[model samples]
Target: MSKANKESLSVGTKIEYRKDFKDIYLPKTMPVIIDVPKMKYVMISGEGDPNGEEFARVSEALFSLSYAVKMSYKSNEVPAGYYEYTVFPLEGIWDLVDKSKPATDKSNLKYTIMIRQPDFLTDELFDRFVKRTKKKKQNPYLEKLTFGEIAEGLCCQIMHVGSFDDEPESFARMEAFCEEEGYVRSDYTHREIYLSDPRKTEVTKLNTVLRFAVRRFR
Candidate 1:
């Protein structure tokens, strides 16, 4: 069914809560499609954690995303993952593109820094643009220094309880709020800020704030 015809969340303008998706957990490397549980999350935006920024890592994501687009210009699909993504600047400790690797049951599901603009990737124009950054040239991700201009719109957040696999319900709460708010989903991005790392804490009681971005409708 067409999403436009159905009532989606209003995002920022008229915030409320709803069950927008059956599953919301996005795999690090691929798009998620399944009957997943729902969880809580809130959406908002502004200057976030700056002192602890990761730059070199971001640069790597930019380069990697560029490479992926360039490689998949002819077809509509990519090798193991999907094309085009919406990325957001998340708070707390974060990993950069180069160093930010996603490890799990799927090895290829690594996080890649990418821009949503599709025109920038076409081989019909910028094929050579993707080749210059050889493996040796890629720089390691380093802590970013947030000094100046930082602009962000909306973010969806929710206090997550338990494991990452069990977070769809909380997200539904946030999505419903977005719809009632009249805020359009910018297709901006989804960021999971780690307040407590599960690796170090009890799996039964992990804390995280899943957030997304949005903007008020004109």
Candidate 2:
């Protein structure tokens, strides 16, 4: 191939989460223990059912900001460390506001939804992206957006296929795996990474990464 062809290929290549972070993003259906590293994200917090309008708005805001950073090179002044990368999938740290409610009760759910930013995204760059996104888009949830690092540390994760409502079956399997492996869940909250777009994919074809922090039995 010519040098120009090579350059085109390099620029076209995107860093895919499944290919680059297989242990974290692409796991087998069976639960496994892994140490998650700290990573940066553009995040927004909200409550109530994820199917509701608020959740949609929060997700939209996060993606808008993430894409702004990913496509910054198109702008006149690119970020110093900017590089080509695919926008990371949307992830959520989920919990319930009312402990008495079962996980099936979506109304009590509270969550922080986020999209992972590329390593080149700094706090300063994040602020600039947010500002640029706000000007380009009119999402009210933009004000709720924040940029930070999250380290999941030791955790158990599994790939879940099927409907989001069917996740408890996978979580149950994860709990059983942890019990057999001498580890226990460390918190009530759990994380979900959406690999397939729910709006576009069928319920039975959805792919999600289900994970929760864990530690060796005391």
Candidate 3:
């Protein structure tokens, strides 16, 4: 972990990533470049339409583990560096299984859905919580969970508000912005941080942070 992140965890105050790292999680509507720090996450990979039953199961498994860590204070063994904080929102890195397939083909999509973990969560602690959650929750997807870190060095991002299908419009604006700034998207894949729950929120009101790696135009 970076010194700043380590310090944030050791302070014992509630660390809300949304409030602290708003630039990354809650970006402005217009595209901008930012350096995303490395952070640990509990992730599950699967290929299929995100709206399918299997996707829901994978998402549930991630939340089950995240909540276990959040509510660990009530448990007999609190984590070594436990602190009060809201659970991070669900995020996904999306791609297509077949390059020839268009983005509109949901069934051809591949994704790794994940929820970010607090800085204090260690590899050993993650395993303990996973084991504990497995016993408490009967979700088979829990076994597929893996813990790791991701560092998106420099990226262009924008706050996309509206239906998921309308994302291409936002991406077009982002790509245009990159071109104006002498940068270009580094890959076809992109990351989305879902700030609104589709189950409770209206499609037009959904807030998603759309981001992709970028490099200076060579």
Give me the candidate number with maximum lDDT: 3
Off by over 4 Å in 1: 1-149
Worst 10 residues of 3 by lDDT: 1-10
Candidate 3: how many backbone clashes? 0
TM-score of 1: 0.36
TM-score, prediction 3: 0.93
| Runs with alpha carbons beyond 4 Å of true place in candidate 3 | 1-12
10 residues in a row with least lDDT, candidate 1: 40-49
RMSD to truth, every model: 18.0, 3.2, 4.7
lDDT of 1 by residue, 1-218 (tens): 23532222212332111122213322222121222222211111223222224433554444453444444423433323223333322233222333354422222222322222232233332333334333334543312211112233345556677776676666677677677766555543455644454448997677655656666675
TM-score of each: 0.36, 0.93, 0.93
lDDT of 2 by residue, 1-218 (tens): 34554444457457887788899899999999999999998888888999988888888888888878877776666666556777899999999999988989999999988888888788888788888899999999998899999999999999999999999999999999999999999997999999998889999999999999999994
Instruction: Please say which candidate is ahead in TM-score: 1 or 3.
Output: 3
Per-residue lDDT for 112-165 in model 3, tens only? 999999888999999999999999999999999999999988999999999999
Residue 47 in candidate 3, Cα distance off native in Å: 0.4
Q: Clash number for model 2?
A: 0
